[model samples]
Structure formats: structure tokens, C-alpha cells
Target: MLGRGSMLVSSLFPLGVSGRRAGVLALLVWALVACRRAPEVSSDEVGEESSPAVLTIDAMDNEQHVLRGGFSVEAGVFRVELYEGSVLLGEALLEEGRWSIPWQPGVGSEFLEVVAYAMAGTEIRTRLDFQRLSFTEPEGLYAAEALLALPTEPDITTRYTLDGTAPGPSSPVYTTPLVLLNKRGQPAPLSLIPTNPDTSPETWRWKPPATPPVLATVVRLQRFSGETPVGPAEARTYLIGQGATSLPVLSLVTDAEHFFGHDQGIYVPGRMHDPSPEGTAGWGTGNYMQDGKEWERPVHVEWFEETGAPVFAQNAGVRIHGSGSAALPQKSLRLYAKEDYGPESFQADFFPGHPLRDFKRLLVRTSGQDQQNSKLKDCVLQGLLRETRLALQACRPTVVFLNGEYWGLHEVRERYDEYSLASHHGLNRKKVVILEGDGLLDTGEAEDAIPYAELLAYVREHDLSVPEHFAHVEARIDVEDFIDYHVAQLYFGNEDWPENNIKFWRHRGGSATPGAGDGRWRWLMYDLDAAFARGAEANSLGRLLRDERMAEPFVVLFRGLMTSPGFRERFVARFHWHLDNTFAPERVLARLDATVELLAPEMPQHIARWRYPESEASWRDEVQRLRDTLARRPEVMRRLLQEELGSP
Candidate 1:
């Protein structure tokens, strides 16, 4: 009879281990039989209510006696069970309010659940109480080495991959704690340089870096039940005493196939190809042209501040970014946050003096057209003009790590869109209208382009010397904003503009948020990499006054506005104010020197990684050239202002 009862208990609830399966069942059956055979004591005789008795877990220690814990209850037999995420680990019956089961947990086992139930006077052993416990968090950057101790469980196997790949049965088995150490060394001198000094990136030839990058151990661990994986894989990156950097660091981890595989990889030349016009080699046609959600890949992003303390680590989506630069060796990537990936917003203060902390999208930029030049031109120009009325993308230079390999320097910038405007100026995103070069609608509805088209027509038909005619144009666009925008671009000698890279926005709704909701157009400053490339004495203002390349509407608007005395006076005054303050030789050179100092430490490894500017010496020469341009630009612009506006 006892054997039959024990068999029933074993069949009903099996303890996870095969050896303890019979033992746990027999113990529970004995406890039940003892409760039944003993004389029944009434609730009144025990001086307790007829209601069910409460159970309390007093002590638990898996290390001391395999798996054991003490419980207290009102005069009744009880049974206990321990579980690791629904997998039954052990079961036992109480002996003098204490129970013990033969079980041992794996390393890094931080959480567990224990359940208690009455064994007597219950149709079946129903759980009356349960408690969950947490030990310690087990993922972070370590100074020396990390002991990667994974949990050990029966039947469930633990596997891991050190190359940032997903773990499977064929991967290395985690039997003991792994002792991981840093494998970083000083970067070797750049042996390979771009052979053609005057060729474009599309026709340029180069090879991957010959030397390996600074190293970190990225362990991706997964537990398996039979052949199926249990839950998501766990990952941790160990820096292992890497040297600190003055700039922040970004570690991006993803599957190797997603980044380097021939057919699917975005970085490689892959299947698609376009023969270069020069016919030397194909320039711009490739798999990198792929865009949209279909091309977006999953990635784990970890950010560490300049001081080496981690800020945020989360999963996000990434896609190739930029126009022509997308085809470069180190491509720019646009990162997105969505519910499908993880969080919907990256919460952090990315730029100094910026109030908003939530960002929906960001750019991991390779400095666009300036990737091979100073690489600081775009960032420096934008930073100088941030106080102006024009909207601009904020930039923060950071070094990146792909898997465990160094990816070199890249800027983390805010992506411009309706969301960006809404965040910065507190306007309704749906009501914002953004148009690019020549009235092409970049954001909002197609109908949003109508107002700009009408404004262009109005400027072309009427003479802006008439006060009413100029007022009509002023009502449609913020004239002061236009002045500031033109001053900054013209001062920087950005030759790409008035025709290319032009962007403007306005609120479609009524006034609600001060200057932002006034339904007047405002300009955005970006892609100033072409700035300061021309000599300091370049006559950008004179070129804008009468250039055949300028579109009809832009030419008509600028020439027409200059005809008005009031408009000319305001533009001259604004230009002088900026030249004295924003573009002062001392102020501009100070910012340039500070930026160079910040990048000096990382430029060696970065130059070796990309082989750009040929060598560190050439890069420094380019930076010095830029410094000379800025130092002389203010004086040159004042002379040009007299040439264009005549004795302001």
C-alpha cells in the first residue's frame, strides 16, 4: 500500500533530477500517511479557527545542506517545493518544521522560488504560499577579469559564444567559470594609405585594417532544454582594464553575418554593383543603397561616459545612413528606438544645455563628406551657430566598438524630423512641415508643400522694394531667422548651399508655442563639411548674389529682399554682430583648438583604422589649414561685406 501511494506521488510531481525522483516522492507519501493514521485533532481542541493555517518560511540555505529551509505552521504536516523559473528543482516533507532535499544550483543562479502546502486534510497538495528571492546582478564592466559563472542544471545544458554570435548546442559548453582577460595592445603604425590623393571615394581603393583593434571579451550565453533554447540569451562585455578615453565610448554588438556576410551585409560590396564612370572600379552602387525597415538590423548598444561609467545598455535597431558617404568604408548608421526592439525612447542628456533627454532616433555618423578631411569642420561650424535662430543637429564625438573590434571615431547626432522639432520647440509633431531642396516634401503630408510653392511664386512676381510686398514675404517667413541663417553659412563659405542641402520648416497649425507656432518658416543648419574648404578670401557672398547655379525662387528671393533698404540694413547689422561675437578670431580658434585636443588621443588608432588623410601628419596639416582659414575669415568677410552690401 505504501509503495502504491509513493508511486502515485512520483507520477503526479517529479522532482527535476532522475536520482531524487523516487526519494522525494516517497518522503511526501510518508508524511501524508502519517497525517492520516494519527488521531484527528479538532480545530477547537487546538484552540484555533476552522480556517486554513498560515505557512511561514523561516530559513533557507542551499549551500549548507544541499537544499534546505525551515517553515512554521499550526500543528499540521506540510510539503515544500523549490523551482527555477517553473522548472521543479526539488521537493520534500517537513521534519520538525524543517525540510531538506538533495539539490545543488548552478553558478550565477540569482533568482529562485519556493512553495509551501499542507499535506494533511487536503484533497491534493495545493500550494498555500510561495516566495521569490533575488541574489545579485551579474553583468557589467570589470577592471581586471571576469569569472563568467553560468548556472549548472540537470538535463538543461549551458552554451556560450565569445564572438558575439548566438549560442547553440554546437557552441562551447559552459562547464566551469571562464576567466576572461583584456587582450588590448598599442596600435601599430599605419602601413597602408590611400594610393590616389585626388580621386573620389567611389573610385578610391583600400583594404581592411591590417592590425587588429583593442580587445574586449563579449560573452553571449544561452541555456538550452534538450535542443530548444530557454528564454533570451544573456550577454556581458568585459573591458578588462582598458585605458580610459577623454571622449565617450559606444560598443555596438551584432551578428557577424548581419554586418559582413556577402549577400546580406550592409558594409561589404556584396551582390549589387555599379561600374564607376571612370571605369577604374565601381564607385557608388552596392547593397549599402538598401534602406527602410527591411534593411534595419537588431543591435545591442552600450554607452560609457568619458569617465568610464556606463550610462545605458539596451537593444535597438540600426540602418545605413547618409547620401554618398553610405558607400564609404566606415558607413554612417541611423539608430532607432521602437517597441518592436526594446524601449521607445533613449533617455539621456546627449548635449550640454539641451533640456530634453528623450530621443527617438540618432545618427552614428562618419563625418559625411569630411570623413577624410579635418572631420571637425561640420561639428565646429554647427556648434558655433547653435545660439542663432537656425535649427541644427547637436553633435557629440565618440569612439565606437563593433563586436570587440575598434571601429574608430564617429559622431552621435540627433536625427532631424517632426519629432526633433516637437521636442525642441514644444510644437505638435503632426502639424510640422519640413521641406528640403527645391520644395521637396521631406516630412508631413504632401499638401504641406503648397504654402512654400505659393511663397516662391509671390516672391518671384512682386518687387520686394515695396514695403507691402516685403511685408507679405516677411509674414510668410521669419526675416531675422533668414538673416542669421545666411550669415552663418556665408561666413563659413559653405559652397554647397542655396541649391543643395537646403531645409526649412513651419508650423501648419495656429499660434500656440511662441515663435515656433507663428506659422513662419525657419531654416536648419547641417552638412557644413564643405565649409572652410575654400580659401578664407573666397567671395561666398558675391557668389550667392549672382550665381547661375542658384534656383529661380532662391535667386529671386535673395535679390528681391536686398532691394529693400530696411532688409539690407538688418542683414548687414546681423552679419557684423556675428562676425564680432560668434565668428571672432579668438573665439573660433579657441573652440577649434579645444576640439583638436579632445580628438588628439584617439586619432592615431582612428587613422590606422580608416587610412584617411594618408597619415596623422597630413590630418594635423589639414586641421592647421582649417585653423588658418577661421583666423582670417572674419577680416576677409568684412571686406566682402563692403564689396557686396557697400559700406554697411
Candidate 2:
């Protein structure tokens, strides 16, 4: 016979025993089982046999188990242990016989295990089970009408939404493969509109819809056992495109670890407030894809674009080039193709068979200044300078993609360096001397700024009004290039000038002739982001030229040249010529309108991604401000010039 406690222990483990040994074994088993159960006595009115503990997973019938969800056991479970393979994930205490856990599985893990613990009398019981799962997202471009079959397992149902909305239980259930299409409908056929009044009818070409067909879908899937939901819902986005555009797409792809992980990544803006250190050292290696072809070589890429997007999927790199942007967020970027880093040349057909194809360094400029000026300031300024036979960098606009994501519009610009001078002027890179606005010598054998410093000293000490001094100043610089450079900067009201954003290069051996090895300083167009109305009023340049408070060497040189009758005459004549021809209101407005039209379709996405304006109307208002500036600036500049320098 057994005591009540002994009978309870015997009932818990079903041990058949007799005499003193049975009592001893019962006590030992009772103590062992008691330690695992809750101290508080559990209700037994329902009877242990009547409501035996049962553990079950409601939603885990799928092969790819999500890392989140709910679990249940028949009203008596006190604790649940979760694990990924052999690694213990965590434990949860059940409330009212149910427990929910947020399962955070390691990247690439495919299996999960759950163990539920319940107390019956003095015994602790457990139910162990496992589920297979994945969190990898689907990638690559998809066409319209393409069928996408999602990975699944038995008893699992997937829900998805194509309108870029998050999927929930009420979303459409996935019964079969999804057929993607332009839910908004096929794009209207393009109409040819002649932009240039002078353009012949035969020259007009069909323009594709400015906005391409893009679809982004989110999928949420859950496993179910009969009517009960199991595990957590797993969700991811699928980005698809209908067709490729004529515009080249530059796609950069990298591992999540390198891109999102801490240390040595571009996303980490270490010491952003200071600009003392020449170059911050956080570069990652990634593959560059352009025009549907991939470059397997590892390129050192960094987060370059700013203000628009945080953690831009698209990065910047140089191929055999050096580094060098725009809006406050629409800043500029530089890329270098150094020999030690990777490939020395970007031999793409950017300008097929042209000298630009083998560029050693490139500049990516954001026309943030254009938005403030006329939405065409930099492009129009560069074009005007080129038309006036001035040496200026060439630039073209292209849409950029980062890690297979659209990164808005960017202009590919020629970097100002020894290589640029060599390529443009057919001069030897070793013999080029480039001087920056801050008086630093960018490239040369001599580290000192002897040549530029001497020129500045000469202008300050001697009276340039004298023909002899004026002749010497002209010898050191191309007089025509200097006049045209000043005209462009002043006419556009570029406030960030003279003291900053200046670049001048000279060939060591050439004469003043174009492409000659003779050395005479020529200005380079740079940082027009601050031009137009962003930094200066229409008459700001004229005011600055006359302001004695401006004491920079470039300003001093300009003031000195203004003292000479011949120099002033040439300057006034050149200004008038540009105002009438290059900066003509009709021509400039036409270019502005064309740029606005080209960017109209793309702006919505760009603004949406960057969150620049409060609303689309605000963006239009900003663009209108540019147009208003363009409409009013030419007259303001003409009036200022007439008042300050006297009418030509």
C-alpha cells in the first residue's frame, strides 16, 4: 500500500513498486519532478486525465518558416523554449495556455525548433518540434505579364499586394503563381515634338514615355494547421520592371554585410561636421553593372550622393580616374580609377570611340543650383561657355541605379585634373600645373605655389592700368579666357567665386594657342550649385566686383584689370556679346523648359524617395522659382552692368 503523496508520484511516472524501496524511489521522483513545476498548486478540479496537456503549432505547415508567430498548448504550459537548429533562441512564459515569440533567426538559417513545457501534477512535461524557414527576398528585373512562382510548403498560404502596400491577412491569398502587369495600364504611345525651332522635321525622333513601368510588390506568408495560425508572418518586397530604357542603367550590387554592417562602409558618416582630413577611409568593394553587363572586378565604392536618400543603394566609384556634386542633399560626387585599387579604365561606350571613353577620373554633379537658378544653370552655362570657345568641362545627364534601385538623375562631368587637361588639350599629364581656388597646387613637380603667388603679387604691387603691367598680366594668363570666365560667372551671379570654387590649369610647355603646350592659366567651371539665386541675386556679381571689402587675390586681380581701359573695354564687349547671344532669354528659357519636361516624369519618384518638398505642389513652386529667376535675372544683370560699368 502507498500514502497519498506516494500514490501521486506513482501516478505521475506509472512506476509499479512495493515496500521500503518503493517509498524511497517515490520520494526521489517526487522531489525531482517538484523542482521543475511551479511552486503554486495548479487547479485539478477538471482532472489531469480529462484535460491532458497538448502542444501544437497552428501556422507552421510551410517549408520556409518565418521567424515570428504564435504557439499554443492545452491550458497548462508554463514555459516554452525556442531554438534555431542546435542554438537556443529564447524562452517565453505562457499566459492562458498560449505564448507568442518573436523568432529572430540568423541570416541564411533554414530551420527552427520549439519546445513547450507543461506541468501535470508534480511532473514537468515537454513537446519538441521543428520547422524549416527562409527570409531571403526575390531579386532581378521582371517583365510585364511575367508569372512569378513564390516558394512554398504544404499548408502554407501567401498573401501579397501589388500597390506597394503592406500585405496582411485580408490581402489577396496566393493560390498560384502571380502574373505581373502594368496595373495602371500600358503607357500611352510617344509623340514626337520638335524641341528646337531650327530643327528640321526629319530630325525629330520618337520620345519614350518619361516614366518607365515599375512595379514593387510586398508579400506576407503564414503557415496554418486547419483554422489556427502558426509562427510569425514573414514579409519581403519584390521589385520588377517592364522593359529597359534607351538610357543606360548603372547597377551596383553588394552583400548586405558590407553595405549595412558597421565599420568601413560609406553609410557611416564619421566626423561629418569637419572637413580637415583630406580623405575619410571607409571604402567597400562591390561589382558594377552598366548597360546589362557586369564587371566582375572588385571596385572600391562609397556612399557619395547625399541629402536625397539615406544609405543610397547606388554608390560612386572611379575607373582609372580620381574623385571629385549639388543641392544641399543633391550634392556632387567624385570617382577615381586608381591603378592600385582596381581597373584603371572605364572602357564603356559612354561616348563610344571618344576620348571620354577612357577617362581616368570622373565627376558626378547634381544640379541643385539649377533648381535655385533656372533648372538649367550648369548645363546652360557650360554650353554657353563652350559655344563662346571657352575651355569648360563636358557634362551629360543620366539616370543612376544603386544595387538595382533607381537613384534619381545625375550628370556625368569631366573631372578637372592633370588627366583632364591632358585629354582635352593633348598635353602630357606630367607637364600640367593645376591651381585650386584656395591657392593649393593640385598637380605638379613643385609643391610650392610659386607661379600663381608671383602672378598675384605682381598684380597687387604694379599698376595694371599701365600698358606695360597689363601686357605682363596678359602673358601669364589667357586674356580672352579670363574675360569670358568672369563674364559667365558675373552674368550668372555666382556668389561662391573669387575666394572659392576656382580652378585654373596651364600646360608647362605649350604657348597660349589652343591645345598648344604653351602655359597660360585657363579657368575651369566648378560648383555651380551655388550659382543663380541660391547664393546671389541677379546683380550680386556686379555688387561684389565693386565692393572693396572683398579682398581675395582673384578679386584684387579683377580690380586691377578693371583699372586698365583696354581690359575694361574688352570685358564690357564680351559681356554684351554673351548677354545677347549665349544668355539670351529666348534661348535660355527654351533650354530650361526642355530640362523641366525631361525631368517632369522622374521628379515624382525622386522627390518621393528623398522627401525633399512637403508636397508635389511645393516642388512645382520651387521649379517655378527657378523660371521666375531666369525671366527676371537677365534684365537685372543688364541693369546692374549698365549702372556699374556704363553701357557698352
> Which candidate tops TM-score?
1
lDDT of 1 at 624: 92
Residue range 1-648, candidate 1, lDDT tens digits: 224444456576565633344445555775776667667888768975565544433232212334445554443434577765567876765566666665444554434466665434342222212211111243444354334466667898888777778788787776655544455553322213221212435434454565566766666777898789986665666666577767888888888767666577666555554343232223446666678787788887877778766678777888888766766667799999888867898888777787778999999998886888898888888999877767889889998888777778999998888988998988899999999988899998989999999998888889898999999999888899999998998998887787887899998975844597898999988888789667899899988897777777666777879998999999999999999999999999999999999998999888887777567898999999998999999999999999878955
The reply for model 2, stretches above 4 Å from the true place, is 1-240, 243-247, 255-261, 270-331, 340-342, 349-355, 368-376, 511-516, 534-537
Residue-level lDDT of model 2, residues 1-648, one tens digit each, is 223444466576575654345445656665565566636656864454654445543322122322223333433333466666678767653445555555433334444556654333232333233222122332333233234455566766566544323345565565544433232332211111111112112222112234542333334444554445555444333333334333333333333222222332232222321233222221111111011112112232322212111121112242212122110233344565655544565444353233555667666555654432233457656665656646676766655543334545666677777887787667788988888865688778675468778888999899998999999998888889889888888876776676767888788766646543667777777666556655225566565677766757668778889999999999888888887888777887787677667666666665554334434577677667767776677777777778888864
RMSD (Å) of each candidate, 1 decimal: 19.2, 18.7
Clashes by residue pair, model 1: 106-152
